[model samples]
Structures are given as structure tokens and as C-alpha cells.
Target: MKLKLLILLLISGYSFSQVKKPDSLQLFFDSAKFSITDAHKTQLQSFFKDIKLDEVLQIRIKGYTDFIGNHVYNNKLSKKRAKATYIFVTNNYQFKAIAQQGLGELDEEIAEATIEGGNSKHRKVDLILSYEKPKEVSVSLTRKQRYLLQLPKLSIGEKLRIQHTNFHISTPNITNASKEDLEGIIKILKAYPKLKVLIEGHVCCGDKEEYESKIINPDNLALSTERAKNIYNTLIKKGIKANRLSYKGYGFTRPLDFPENTIAIQRENRRIELKVLRK
Candidate 1:
């Protein structure tokens, strides 16, 4: 009876170990439309909701268009689709590494058949996520301390937003309220001697022209960059090594909230974030 019980337990363990989670997803779009629909957005949220950032190894996205358009048009459309998906994923989730490519039109035979059948599969983006299962470990630490420990494990391109790290209006000056957050970051850097990061600054509420045309109003860009530099300088002042840090400003280009219609949303957009470069 003991031998039979042991065999049953071993078999169950092997079966559990062999269980596989899905590694790929396909998101469809309306004809010639690059934007993700509400339905697809909900699907995406459900798909990614359970994924842990630390376990992700890489994400690759590929966009494809139907054969109804000319090569040039289809190629550009595919790129737009890819960009839209990429932006949505990056804004919503944190991951180690991600890459996107526009594969343009589907194969001619497949496109023709799909079109004849009124299928929309060709107008789609494929997202392939690869990750490793993290090992189970028991540790007793405060939430902030655990976050500090995880900082060193992040791969390049992964970002950690410094919550409440906001600045004075239209200036690079750090707000008094944000000092504690900065100190927390400094503590993490001091704890992990080999960790390196790039400070990124962003702002909110700008017109399309202001966002795109640097020549028309370069100050926004400069301001953002300076904000990041302010954080870099503060870290240096706090005794973090200068060689382990770099900074850049993105202005109003990467807002967390689009249109910037509300004060609260705009406040969320106007903040500083850090990208892990080395661990």
C-alpha cells in the first residue's frame, strides 16, 4: 500500500510539472483599422491580468494586413497596428523585454481565401509571450523592502515608476512631497551596488503640434529632460555613484492618460520613472 501511494504521488507530480500555459495570443482588428477595439482591449486585459512581470522573459509582436491594399499602404497600416498594440501593452504591463515587427500583408493564397470567406484573421496582430516559472520561495519582508530586492532582478527595458514623484509646474524642480519617494529609490540603489538605471521624465497636457514639433516648442522636451536630470543629480547627492545612472526626457510624448482632460489624470501623467539597465 505504501509503494502504491508513493507511485501515485510521483505520477501526479510529473503531470503537474508537465502542464503548460498558453504562450501565444492573436488579436483581430476591423478592416483597415489600426486601433484596438473595446472587445479586444477587454480580451487583452483578461489575457495579461494574471501574468507576473518578473517571470516574463520576452514578448514579440507581429502585425499583418489583408491583401486588399497596395504593398506600400498595407505595410504602413501593419506598422501602425503594431505600434498601437505595442503602446497599449507597454502602458498597461511591465515586462523584461519586448519587440515588435510589421510583417505587412499575409501570404497571397491565404489572403485570397480568407477574403473570399469573409474572414478577418489576416487583419491581426500576434503576441507571443515567453516566460519561465519563478521558483517558490519563502521570505519575510515589508512590501517596500521586497520591491527594493526585486529591483536588481529586472532586465533591461523594464521600468519601475516612482509613485508620487512629481515636480513643480512646468519646471524641473522636484516637489517637496516627492522627497520621500526619491529617498526610497536612493535606498534601493544603495542596497544593490551593481544595479544601474536610466531616469525618464514625462509631462502632460500639450497640443498635437507641441508634442510633435520640437522646433515650435522645444522647452517641453528640455523641461522633461531636465526633470530627469534633477532626479539623477539628487541621487548623486544622496551618494549613489554617478557612473550607474543616466537620464532622458520624453516631454508629453508618453502620457499615461490621453487628451489630459482631468486634473487627476494629468497629475498621473506628469511624473518620473526609471528603467532598469543592468542588474
Candidate 2:
């Protein structure tokens, strides 16, 4: 317990110096248009790309709409605007958002305009970011921390994942322990519902051509592909939203810490790599 508290203090010490990237950003739609503009798309891409490595403590995206339309229409429009931005962010950054809400015409006293392209400012979505902070001196150390604590802020093109402890060379199954480990990731996704991830499956034994020839029963290509798909399905079966996850098979194409000579290294190769696509 003392060691755990010491580690928490150390992490909190580092977190105290960290700041949220962007702090706040926003997306605007054309009048009566709920879709994000292409210009805005480039802006968002550039903005998030710059902060790819920053630790994202919390993501909040709030959407708003002008009062030009009826209360019902405006409220729905605001949600659409927010959803578009949420999808865009998740598809690109793969960061799960803490909150995604539509404040439909809330706090707006604008005179309703019937003309086209009226009240552009209100048709917008705000992307707010929050950073980690140190626990108060008075606060007690606890094992239960935010879900983000267990996750690494995935880089744009970099591959990352929690290793499955129960993987077998003869099986294409995700073991019980592996499923439990994956449940931690589900919590992270729940915290950031709008986030999207690309799951890549890689296998060991030999290169692509070699696996095609050597591996019997289901082909080597199928082995990796099935693993990736199973992870994707497991998340779905466990009630994770389907739209947020994608999987691909790269059978022995991408290797880490090369010279995969040992059994441990080969096991490392037969693993899943989660890449951020939208956050």
C-alpha cells in the first residue's frame, strides 16, 4: 500500500505539470446545414494532428444551434451538428469523448430569421479538453482512478494494445483472461463514446508467403485475420458500439523489436495493435 501510494504521488506530480491541448476548439456549420464544412475538416485535422502526443484527460464536445428554426427543428439540428463533429473526431483522432451533448438553442435570444444562411454562429459544436491534475493533499490515495489512467493516449499512426495473456499457438481464440483484460479497454471506450479505433491483427511463425504454404487447417492469413475480427466482435458482443471499431489483418507484415527469434518475441508478434482513427 505504501508503494502504491508512492507511485500515485509520483504520477500525480507529473500530471500536475501537464496541460490540456487546445483547451477548447469549435466546429461551425453552414446556416440550416448540420454537416461540417470541408474547410473546418482541414482545420480540425491540423489541430488534432498537432496534439497527437498530448495526454487527453477528458474530451467534451457540446453542440449548439441558432433559433431560426422551430424549437423542435433547432433542437434536432443541434444534435445533428454535434453528431457530425463527434463522428469526425472519433474517425480521425480515435479519442473517446467524455461528453457529447446538444445544447439546442439554449441561452440564445436571437430573433428568428426565415431567410437562408441566417444565424451561422449558433450552428456550431465546441470541442473542449481537460487535463489531469494532482490529487489534493487532503485526498486519500485510492486504487480506483479514472479509466484513462489505464490507457495510453494513442498516437495518430502508432500501434498500441494490451497483450492477451492467454494466446495459444494452436488456437484462434481470445481466452478468458484476455477477455477480462479487454474489459478494461471497454471502460475506456465507455468514457469516450465517440472515439473510434482501428484494430490490426499480426501473426508470427513466418512471413506472408511462408504462412500461406506452411500453416495447415486454417491458413496463416486466416489466423491473424480471425484474431483481429474476434477482438472486434468481442467488443461488439460486450455491448460496445459497432461504429467505433474497425479491424484489419496484416499477417506478419508489421513486426516490433525485430529479430523475432524467441518464443516470447513471437508471441508478441501474434498480437493486436490498436490505432487511433477518430477520438
Candidate 3:
């Protein structure tokens, strides 16, 4: 029972504090000179000292004149008075009083109240309450265009299309790919499920193979086939339907580089490519 009563008291006190309105205070104008008298100074000192956090407080420092000068001129003077008040509060009170704003002569207390001249009490600077500084929070997230490819664990029915060429093939290179590259690839794949991709694998021309010289070494073709198979297995493990994914090897037949029979050409030929067929 005692614990329940304590919790209730805490809740009630918090509610009351949150709903409390800011205190409003009025200060007489210091005339056109915009100088607060000694009496006003004492009151202001007391007000500043009493200011507390989580509470709103407002002060309207105004300027007034007898109907001696032009109405327009009086309005301008009132604005100056408000500005001066703001400066005083910010400089003297630091951030103790959040800040102050000048409403100028627009918010006249008396629409047509006149002192010496037919002037209104519109020239003033009204102080307002400010909210507390919001707390900062940290978050982790992937940026736009971030790519990740979970390899050795590709999803079933997942199809990845490369450039439109014989090199197009889904090889399980993701196993060795960095997180960034993997994510990028996965992101694209997920975006288009209906799209069908053909993965092709290739091999370098001068690779060492036992029957190369005699049997017209299909080293490139064999290497390319292996790469394609690796990718196919990965995708199958990922739960992608086997029918959705297809693999093919250009076997150095299709060269991304020169079409000649040079070692450099073979290197370029030894690459896997993906192409969208159904999409």
C-alpha cells in the first residue's frame, strides 16, 4: 500500500509540473529614452533570480510617449525599447531567461490610450518561454545504395543479371566479396523479383590444365563452368527455387576485352557476367 501511494504521488506531482503555465510579468515603459528606472531594476533583478528550468516566464518591456510625436514615430520608439529590453535580459541573465523577442508597437495594451499625446501602448518587447533542449539519440542504419550480398547462402529463386553479354552469369563470388559489395548486389536483387538473370562464368586462356595441348585445352570453359556452379549452389541453399535460377559458362569464348588470342584478352575473358532475360 505504501509503495502504491508513493508512486501515485510521484505521478501527480509530475503531471502538475508539466501542465504549469509560465509566469507573466509587466514592467512600465522607461519613456522614449528606453531606460528602466532604479525601482524597475530591483524588480528585474528579483525576477531573474527566481527563474527556474522547466518553467515558462514572460516579460513585456514596453515604450510609451505622450501624443507629442507622430504616431508612426512613437511605434518605432516602442520597438527600440523592446530591443533594448531584449539585449539587457540576454546579456545580464545569460541563458537563465532563455531569450526575448520584440513585438514592437503592434501589440498595444490600449488601442488608443494616450499619455501626453494620443499614443497607444503598442510599442513593447514581449518575453516568451522556451522549451528545453532536446536530448540527442544515435542510430545505425544502411545508407541509400548500400549493397550486401549474402553468398554461400544465396536465396532460392534469386536471379542476378549482369551486363548484357555472354559474361552474364550468377557466380557465387559473394563468398569472397566484401560486405559493402554484397549488400549492394542483394539490394538490387530484392528490388526486382520478376527479373530473370543469366549467370555466366569464364576462365583465362593460358591456365594450366593437363590435356590443354592435345585436347584444345577448354581450361577457360571449365573454370567458367565451376564459377557458375558455385553460384548456383549458393542460390539453391538460399531457398531460391532451382527453376528461377539458371547458370551458363562462356568458357573464354566470349571475351570482355579484345577478341584476339592474347594472354590479356584471356584474362578479360575469364569473368562471369549476368544478364536480365525475362525482365
**TM-score for every candidate vs. truth?**
0.52, 0.45, 0.33
**lDDT for position 32 in model 3:** 60
In angstroms, the error of model 1 at 17 is 18
Q: Where does candidate 1 have its weakest 10-residue lDDT segment?
A: 133-142
Report the candidate with higher lDDT, 1 versus 2. Answer: 1
lDDT of 3 by residue, 133-204 (tens): 333223222563221222212222222333212232334353333334334434445444554556666555
Cα error, candidate 2, residue 54 (Å): 16
| lDDT at position 78, candidate 3 | 57
User: Rank by lDDT, descending?
Assistant: 1, 2, 3
- Per-residue lDDT tens digits of candidate 2, residues 190-244? 7667668887777776654433333332465677788888889988998898898
**Pick by TM-score: which candidate is best?**
1
TM accuracy, model 2: 0.45
lDDT of each: 0.76, 0.65, 0.47
Q: Per-residue error at 147 for model 2, in Å? A: 9.6
TM-score of 1: 0.52
Q: Write the per-residue lDDT of candidate 1 for residues 1-279, one digit (tens) a residue.
A: 999999999999999978776687889888999997888799999998777767778888888887665544676888899889999999988889998877666654445643454447788888888786444334444454455455555544446667768787878998887776777787778767778998988877766665444332477789989999999999999999999999988777555545567999888878787878777
